[model samples]
Structure formats: structure tokens, C-alpha cells
Target: MQSNGPLYLLHQGQVVKFGFRVERRHVNPMDNLHGGMMASFCDMLLPLSVYRKDSAVGPRFLPTISLQIDYLAPAPLGCWVEGEAELLRATRSLVFAQGLVRADGVLCARVSGVFKIGPEFTPETAKP
Candidate 1:
């Protein structure tokens, strides 16, 4: 994830917004944002919609069960890409989320994911 660094997040009610600038490492040979990078960004960002500090589940690890991404347009180098994710539904054991990725307000990708709720997570448990 460090390779994709300098990620920023903003919480707005139930929606989570994320932003990142496209650097050289984030682009493909054609100087456009790489698809894999976009997918990884979505994977990391969408789960925030299911996170709640006051919920019975508390803070838990979310493991992706399925991720679907539709690429709509290209994001050129140096563009600032922004994304917004929201929880569509969540059960005790699963969470569903959808998100959109845009570059300078132009739609770039549409994403949806299903995540399995895992055991309680903390910084200690996150250590390798």
C-alpha cells in the first residue's frame, strides 16, 4: 500500500470520500492511471462505509468476498482522483458497498464489493 501512498480520507455522514494524486508509479505505460491501482484503491476505501465505532461489532477486519469494477474512462497522469463509497447493506456477517471513482469530476470507474465481517481488529492484531 505504501506504493500508493499519500491517500486522504474524509467522512461525511455515511459516505466516505478518498483522494489521491496520480504519480509516476500509479500510471501505466500510456501515462494513464493503472487499472490495478484503481482496484486496490477501491478495495481499501469501500470498507470504511461499514465501519462504526458504536456498533455491536465494533471495529473489525473486513475481508473482501467479491469485488466488481467497471472501468468507464481514463485518468491521465497528475490528475487528482477522488472516490466516494457508501454502504448499501450490512448484516451481522457481511457488508455490501458501492463506490464511484472520478478524476477531476469525470467518471472513471464504478465499483461494488461484498465483504465478510471478521474478528475484532486493532493495531496490535494488524501487526505481521
Candidate 2:
């Protein structure tokens, strides 16, 4: 589950909503979500934002140069964490996005990220 690869390939869509049933394995010793898990969600958000509109371009598994997140509340085991990302801006070499994560219908995390578009990256090469 820690893998960077999308959990489900069909994960890229306009209304790309994703939810995962949190388990004990997803928890920290404190019975709350481990920070890394939430962090990973931030990582997933950007690539999805690009693919959601067009699956073959915009995102090339680019490395995030900067990622900042805020924990609004605790996320516990057995709760499904779900969220969406919206593209704030897009340029030839960068994309900015924001995302939210809700646990039990409460916003548990909010995030902002920037993706550095890499070489050979262009929307023209996109394929359905």
C-alpha cells in the first residue's frame, strides 16, 4: 500500500475520488494515522490532478520539489480517508495543486503541492 504506483489504474478521471479503508496497519502506535501515510497521499494528489484531465500527459511521475501539508485533525483506523485535488495553475514546466483529506467526513488534512514538469513532458503527447 506504500507503493507510489496508483492503487487502481482507473484512478485517473475528472471526478477522481479515492477512498481506502484504513486498518491497524495504517496506524501509528498512537492509534492515529502515521504521518508517512498522509504524506504519501499528498504525493498521489498531484499526479492524479494531471492525469484526471488527460491520462497520457501533464504528469510524468515528476519529483516534487516542495510539498507542504497541514493536519487539521486526527485520522483513526477503520475510517476511510478520501479527497480530491484541483489544479490551481499550469504552465509548461510546473503545476500547482491543492488537496483535502477527510476521515469520517471531517477534514483531517489539507495540502498544497507543486510538481516540476520534466523533460519530454508535454500535453501534446497525451493519449487516451
Could you say which candidate leads in lDDT?
Answer: 1
lDDT of 2 by residue, 16-128 (tens): 76566667767899888888888887678656666576544454655687788999998898887787777777777777888888888999999898887665545775443
Q: Write candidate 1's Cα lDDT for 1-128 as tens digits.
A: 56687888777565567889999999999999999999999898777555742254448888899999999999999999998877787787988888899998999999999999898988989764
Provide the lDDT at 74 for model 2: 89
Cα TM-score per model: 0.89, 0.78
Candidate 1 regions with alpha-carbon error over 4 angstroms:
52-58
**What is the overall TM-score of model 2 with all chains considered together?**
0.78
Best by TM-score: 1
Shift in Å, residue 70, candidate 1: 0.4
Off by over 4 Å in 2: 1-13, 54-59, 119-128
Candidate 1: what lDDT? 0.84
Structure candidate 2, residue pairs in collision: none
